[model samples]
Target: MAKASRESGTPPVERAARASLHPVPDGRAPASAEAWALIDSARQSYIDALPIAAAVLTEQDGDLVVGASNRRYDSLDAARPASQPMPIIESPTIVRRLLEFFARPGDELRFEWRYGDQVSGRHFHACISPLAQVPGGNGRCLLTLVDRTTEIESTRSLRAELLHDSLTGLPNRTAFAEAVDEVMASNDGARHAVLLIDLSRFSRINESLGGVAGDEVIITVARRLISTLRAGDILARVGGDEFGILLRLANGPDDAPAAARRIQSVLSTPFRLARFEVGIECAIGVALVGEEQTSGEELVRNAQFSLKRAKSTGRVEIHHPGEAACARYKLDLETELRRAIDQGDLRLAYQPIVDLAANRLTGFEALARWTHATRGVIDPGEFIPVAEEAGLIVPLGRWAVDSALATLAKWDALAGSAVPLTMNVNVSAIQLARDDVPGVIAAALATHGIAGSRLTIELTESAIVQDPERTTKALQALKALDVKVAMDDFGTGYSSLSYLRRLPIDSLKIDRSFVSGMLQDRDKVAIVRAVLSLADALGKTTTAEGVETIELSQTLAALGCSHGQGYFYAAPLTADAARDYWQSQL
Candidate 1:
């Protein structure tokens, strides 16, 4: 009857009834033809729909023997065809382990496994599930292989974009900061350091060369930085012209300085950018992270502060915060500057400007001085900029003009000679732009009973170059009052020649930098000589400032310079001292 059931494709119940009728004591039962057909149809459908390769393996002494494989599995290895047995040793380590575990005889178990291809280096994820057995049948393991290479590569690319600079493909600030945080969190015994690098004069380069050239310069800097960094050190671009570096597992503070020096050496080399050779200099600041628990943000801030200090002091690198005390002191001084001005603690010192050919004092240049209550005499370099930024310069400059006029009046009275006393007052661009400047000068001259010709207003090249047309009208108004006008710090700005030709000026004062350079560089000397000739041709007087030595003074005299003012003649003096010096000279 069972043989008849198998031949006729009877159902499982019908096959069992037939087997019972045979009454086999061993309980050997045959699967019905109907059940066998259903199993084959389900397996074929699953294999056809699955995108990944599917396979079945039998357990044998912790090894897998291939029982069945779909077309996809066979295609994965053309050397092995479906139903062809392959030893576990032929597969990768991960695959072999997965097969060994999944093939164990027990209830169904499932797990995820990864495999790497030896030939293509491609990675795949496999989901392994133990197959359910019929009442008395052997178990098998079902494996599904899914290719994960594309997904993995896409993930890696996204991470790279987040962690790296888009322009130079270097790590960015966020990534570098995270790395530092991780290292510090690990509490590594070795010392670590952060180096902050800021490009010097980058703004000037950007303004002069444009953004394209600037980008080239940045790329060159990145390449040089990469070359300079040692193993385990990471570099990142933090700002427009700022870079940060993290040196992991450093030896100590000594290691930081040496590393910083190497970076500086690399940066000092000239970079060739699009037909222009640009010499780049960087100010470096290094901070060490030792056993001290520090936040990454705090460390970065410290390094940045130190870098600013390095720039302000013109130092190559500064490691400690103490080096920045000068900047802090300047800040404090600035805070007190307004009070100084309000309290009349600020005073003007006059330096006698001598006529070179006549060998006589022609006028006085009014220099602002600050006498701090506690710090004694504060240098103008310390407080003048503060006053300017605080909007105190308007009042300060007016006071300077009034004070100088008063001093000139007093000097004339004491000397008992009209002497045609001229007082030169430095005027900032902001002051010149004020509509009341001409009125102020007129009022000052009227108050002091000094002739307008005896009062010279010194305007820096920057003042006129900033707005030539407007400055010209302002100067013309002052000149209408017969006040002498002199262009100060000449040859240090754009359009010096053009301004000289166009603007109404009574004198030209060469910048001190040019005057100092003229002593050593012949080109500078030639420039000075040419300026003097131009001034002569234009009927304009020339004053050479920063004549600190007798040689410089003599050189200016030989070059036909008309006026000179510098430490060589005399340091700026108090009003009384200047009056006394003029009397003695007379």
Candidate 2:
């Protein structure tokens, strides 16, 4: 008994002797002294060799008793001293689970429990198996415990890493989305707002420095943005240079823009990046959570649409109803446009540019037109911006260049001579910046056996002024090909004479707004006259747009406007119609 007790770390003989209740209460015969001794010896041997904590629990009449327990089991309770041994089955939860396991009579029953405080808790998985073979030990069970603290803590760490940004240690998009959902669901009565912040020209940082420097900038910006938030606001790194914030507004929708301004104010200061102090600007979009905006994803998406608009205006924009729907439609349209470009499903229409004095067709400006599979006639105004945003402008611009030059070749073939027509193709700022505009134009001119002098590349004022140095280089390259360059919508953008003289431009297309009412509006007339005078002085020609009346055309010609294009000449026409129009003009 002493040897067994020493090995098992429990005085089994004393515990069995002190037991008042009988195991054979139903009148079954009790085991012999030698048989009980043998049973105790086997139980001690089973738990003694086990690495984990082990114990034998048995039911005596209506009460529970510990039949045998190993040294490891006694050590499970940190509060108990080594000199004083106590059974680890003292927990009420463990006891209840063990009692339930005893009644189940299963092969094995498993459960988990924790000890100590939540922050410093140790977890354990306990398994119980029936030991029904012991005589007068009908409800006896064997229990073993496996510590699961390390595994549980490791799983929690991984989960935390997944939801947080590694560099900034901020919540990630998924976690932020989840948090937004929870906030909305929990407080339906209160108003909420979602703000999306996009760093303007953020790519310049990464391009000029490196990705490591970009990461540092983002982290610093994240900290600065957090400083402007309220107590309940949730900020997350949602994109490469985008951050999202969820604010529970106390005063309603009006608070949204104010919060945005606060964020902007915090970021107005320059950031000290390495040895360089760089000024950064941001565009913010706010979307109020209406009754209809129930999900976090929807709110964030609406805010994103607003953010896109804000980027253009460099202001804090609030989301309006139907904007989300419009944004989604644009997204779908962009995808379709990409497919259309790949499949050559797009075509161009030509609008005649007439010589004001001679009333003769000088050239045709090629306008892109798309007829959807079902939606017939998609406007260039709609899809052009989408293409620019989605980076599809490069390929689309390439295709347009080739197609326009190819049409010019076909027209030359039909006329039996090189038609004195210049194909004016509209080129986007994105094409100038990202695409090889000069190379593309040169290749198209070469492919169609067309002279570069017969092609004119039209650009918006905004396009030229975006990156003037780069634009000048690109324009110089195009000039080397002997192609003409015309600035479209001349008066609307910067309109700096410095740019006019610096660029190797041949003509300027007066914006339709100024030309539309130039005959009546004195201000419009003056603007047109000034543009014409400037163009003539720079040795460049001028094309007056939106000339709808004979009086307007005569008036423009009298004012020395070299060319005009509008309904007065012709609407944009197909290749066949354009050829016919040119032939008739002859």
Candidate 3:
């Protein structure tokens, strides 16, 4: 029991036994055999070992006296203490320094230091408490050495992995978020800027050369950016090809663009990769943190909004109140459009397409319309682009097609085959990109029992040219179903007569710009003539849009335009007016 207590640990009863060199008197010993046996079976553990490098040092004199120590004390510093009763200071210089911490009356002090390279992987933390008061009232102290090298190293490694980009050694998005919040919360009344540098067409490097070369380009960009920025600026790789920079203590909001311009100027130079000279373009969005932008998320969101504009215009965009309002309006329109769609608040306006040669109605192009009870009518020019960007164009386009088909079926029912008219529905590029467009159109036609020949699908030349293979395939499938396809806004897109020859298009609609300008501009007149002649040669029908006067209508008819659609025929009318128009025309 005594051997166990002596070897167990350092505690009050064990510490009391080491108070004096001599044994305690018999009367002072506990009255039980268990207690006497504890002291009689073994020597005090404290005096058994010297105190320099123990897990705990009980007491020390100016001369380095005895104390309780674990088995570590003997092997520490790789030196054993003297067998004679002597101070540890007489043993080694390192031992003397360890005992010196508790020599004076002071609070506990923590120490971390290393010895020579002999204990390379080990770190010693010395916790020294001077003149510790024990139950026996001895003038003792405690000193402990703990090894925590692995723990500290692991913590540091984890932090670095979480906060830094491995390849570039730049701070990652996590670090950027924290920095943005800290800067926003600082409230130092100094403007800070966040610029998102997005590399345009950066994938060309990987596609043209390889991914390794792409990595080289990324590193080169990182180095160029770091060199271009001021010392206090921060640069981080927040995305694969996007770099985020935080400019602290900007002089004004203009400082953001000025800093971005400097970095952009540096990046404008071509990067010389292995066996390739690659040029790069960057779209920079600069957002200044202020009262409205209160967080990293808001800052990045505003910057992203600016980036979209920068990508289009190929210039730097500073986030302003106007752009913020525009972004908010787009979001508002998206919500309202979704509601309009779900509630069937959307309607179609029909603009009459006239057969000038026959002097009668040929078809009507269905235009989608939306009117908010509070805000009045929303223009298709505004909402259509917004819809496309939001990926809502496909759904809205399908609905418009379905509703128009059903309306056309009703019109045919009312007409009773007297002059059965074709109805045209415009399709966006996003709609045609889907493989299900043919299926959707077929379903709508079958649901209404409308002939595909009486339904013309008018699409912008640009939309068809975007993805020629997929679009051409979709168009061919429609043609297989006996649907007629017309290239709307023909001259505005980059497609040539050769491209038109490759597709199974039935007609070309001359863009309104040319039709509206042909009377004034000779080039417009020439473009009109050329489109008409080309259509006649290709055995395709021609439709002249934006005909506003009788004279212009006569000129287009003489120039071989088979159909015309504009204000001259009739403005776009509501569904009720359209139903009344077919009745009146009869």
Candidate 4:
């Protein structure tokens, strides 16, 4: 029991309770003490049935007296000793609000209150409703406290999960946009930029190493990127091997490029993984925030558009005003290209490969051509790279192989084995890296009833140099299938001559740049002669591309080039035209 107040000669709660039970007035019958006790017991019983903590409070002398309460309500102060009376509303702020609610006849007050620390404490939603006034003593109110601690913690955990990336513990794309939104909303005329960094050739790492190694690389990149940022900047893992950075530039848009250079510098050093050390490069794209920007997501999208351009140009690119439309058009084209490949709607054009020495038709190079139903004749230069970047090249390559082989079969039936010509199909690096190229070729050959020797798989130096060991293995597999492998567009990429010695390269297709003006350009002629000399020494055949004139053809033949393909021979033709041309040559 609490000690009495000497001035009042009574305990505070007892005095307040006695003050609340004053006699009734205005012709009302004075209720018996027993009846009043029964009424109080019924109120206690009613509140005890409530799921949450509940109590009936009466206002006395600007303070709340607990007239009746449930056991749950009493448990709120369980830390206090059993000798002391239970306190109704411990928070003075809550008691003040309840007192205010008592003054209003029909008003209800609702609020949230915490029992202890802001972060690690119990939370409760407190609601107080005014009850009918006590007979001339004080107004009464019912207070209920619903514990919201579990619910609040759950919400906090869910929000954290949603906002954070599981792999890197950085902000994800969604959370980055929210942070960008906050920055935009609070912008005080300061310039900002979004830099999207894509780790170059990252898929190759995943292919050469495992996905776990790839994840390690991504985590390392995230950490290094964080090291290059200012205190106010935000960095996020927006993609598998791509990151987005939001910067509040201290010195306008120029700061973005500087930051990009800094990022590159940090990432320049090779990463030491579990097994081996590997080097990496990145392409950065920047989109500056402008007054005309609509939202944060739009800015991030613009940054992505710039990133796409950066991948192609191999430089840091900024988003221009009209780039969005260009990006959308490219997206639409990619969609159409995917649909075209799936439907077998794309066409193949056969360009003749001639025997330069004999001046006779020996084979044809299979070139993929798209004659869009609505937009006629899309250039291969336009869509080929698009297919490679969009990861549609595998299916596109498969379609090309099947179509070309089927065409060859039809031509063979027409020629009746009179002309034994080869069909060369160009293969992209993406196909070699991600697909079973030899298996696909074997299946296509079997399906078309064509011998593997008659099919030549043309590969660019870039394709071979991406993963030399894998490329060598794939080429060896193709060699096992007895398919001729020609290095297409040779001498264009940064391939070492040692690769030529090590790889199972049977023929070299001299790129157009060396063959187009060999007669007029002595340098080009010398390069062609050297390529031919090298091919002859290596026991490999040489084919000259873009030999557009008879004089150039003679020059290449004199240089010991075995085959030639150019405008001088024939342009890429349709299935019927190619058959007619071959028959004419016979």
Residue pairs that clash (backbone atoms under 3 angstroms), model 1: none
lDDT of 3: 0.77
- Strongest candidate by TM-score: 2
Q: What local lDDT score does residue 27 receive in model 2, on the 0 to 100 scale?
A: 69
How many clashes would you count in candidate 3?
0
**Candidates, ranked, TM-score:** 2, 3, 4, 1
Please give the distance, in angstroms, between residue 272's alpha carbon in candidate 3 and its true position after superposition: 4.5
Say which prediction, candidate 1 or candidate 3, comes out ahead on TM-score.
Answer: 3
TM-score of the candidate numbered 2? 0.82
RMSD of 1: 13.7
Per-residue error at 148 for model 3, in Å? Answer: 10
lDDT of 2 by residue, 42-66 (tens): 8678788899988877665545666
Instruction: Give the alpha-carbon lDDT of every model.
Output: 0.75, 0.84, 0.77, 0.84
lDDT of 1 by residue, 17-129 (tens): 43334322366665455655565556657775788887765554544455556777666656443333432225555355555565455544444433334433555676667
Model 3: residue 56 alpha-carbon error in angstroms: 18
lDDT of 2 at 64: 64
TM-score of 4: 0.69
lDDT of 1: 0.75
Q: Which segments of candidate 1 are over 4 A away from where they belong?
A: 1-300, 303-323, 389-392, 412-419, 429-436, 513-524, 548-555
